[model samples]
Target: MHESKLIIAGGSGFLGQVLARYFKTLGWEVIVFTRSPQANRVAREVQWHGETVSQWTRELEGATAIVNLCGRTVDCRYTTKNREEIMDSRMKPTRTLGEAIARCKNPPSVWLNASTATIYRHTHGPAWNESGEIGATPEAKDEFSVEVARAWEETFNTTATAHTRKVALRTAMVLGDGPNSVFPVLLRLARLGLGGRMGSGRQFVSWIHEADFCRAIEHVIARAEFSGPVNIAAPNPLTNAEMMHLFRGLVGMPFGLPASEWMLEVGAFFLRTETELIIKSRRVVPGRLLASGFQFQFERMPDALRELRMRMTGDVKCTLPLPAI
Candidate 1:
């Protein structure tokens, strides 16, 4: 008898792809929901329109959990149009999935949704907990990091299911391989002698490894005790400069010139990306995940980057101190 599997919405994304594969390796079947046309893969495919729930609701039959990673990338610049798309993209699938779970004859016991860490204020030197001061829009910036982050969480929390355990993952940047990889891209730039800190290099970057990220999801799914907002990030936090140094070390390049806040703003304006992502400091901690007994395989940033580099390029390099947490 095979162990039952879980359902993953947006399972084709970078993070979702890693997670779907991870769960498969653990001998659990995976049902992926996406708006894209069917692509051949290891997991079962369920067609979704992103506007209304489909008959794919049957996929939840006898499933172990449902992890919803569906949301527009917050990395993009926030224009009025982008804002609508972001909100709708996030809320639509959320409402659809929640409604589907609510209507399922046998819904998965766990429902984990994607959220953001920018939801917390990042006023350098200040620390935020699950209870500490949540973010208010910083007066200096026009970007809607706090607003979008708040609305994203609000949409998830209000849309509920009485039968299913809903877990919202207030996650930070998830670094890994293939597309959306922060390593090879940054390392490639580093190898090209372009690697350096963005903006002031003082902003805090909270992250989770690809391997451990999968485990954390599984931990939440199987634990049966964890619910509500959980911060999925590394215990060992680092600054933008620290991250740049690690990357430069990995790719054998001296850390190059740092991009000032103004430069990032100008560049992001052209690229339609958000500068607050790299400009505003976010010293976020994983207070809930740690206390919940979720052990991370690579809690430290340097180690995680090294392992990821090894996996991608098959190159062995200098070692890093593993995080005890």
Candidate 2:
């Protein structure tokens, strides 16, 4: 019997690479659709423009699963040109894929589209779940990020794919070992003695380990009942201060200096990124996943950070030395 095939659109980035490798290890033939096709890639690569339909659409004809992670990174300054590209990057590829799938004689059974926790309103109190309300408005400063997510998901949901089960993954900051991941950024700050709370330190940081992220994607693929938007985040949400403190402990650092909102704004300007990435309270929870009995491997910040440290440093036995819970 032939192994099942999985097609990943925009599978060139950090998360996409991780997912591609993951499903491939499970005996699935992974096909990656990327802009810059590398000669050294393990998975079969198909060059794509991301905006228009082409021969790449044929890869979707008889695939087991299709995952689209083609959005432009939201880590840079929200310039007018950048904002337009950000929206278009996500919207165009999503719509194009939907159209391709609809035209397929044997469309993939599941289609998991990338969305973000930023789609939820910035909240500090209650944890926003999959059923949470959409938070971005045209007048909001961080409206660009929210709008991009909204439009990406809307394109996925509205596009007619009767044979395919669609699931919008409202993911959070994924903590992993890769250089492009958020882990290295925080680790650098901690090593420089600046791994402290940002602004008021009360902003909630909803996150998930990379392992859990891959697992959740597989879980959704297996469970036919899970459709529409699903929160792919750890159930426990921590404040910015608490998360940083744990990161410090994981790296064996004792202390870090806190940054005020004004300081954050200045640093962001110099770094050419937005302070909204740090200041916004992303208090999201995987209510649907937990309710559906999806158990998280690393539910706590300490556990997740420790796992990341092991992967980075290759010291498997370096346990957490902090005080007990």
TM-scores, all candidates, are 0.93, 0.96
Q: Write the per-residue lDDT of candidate 1 for residues 36-71, one digit (tens) a residue.
A: 747687587887876787788888767788888887
* Deviating ranges (above 4 Å) for candidate 2: 137-141, 321-325
Q: Candidate 2: how many backbone clashes?
A: 0
Candidate 2, residue 146: the lDDT equals 82
Model 2: weakest 10-residue lDDT segment is 135-144
Number of the predicted model whose lDDT against the real structure is largest: 2
Over 4 Å off, model 1: 139-143, 319-325
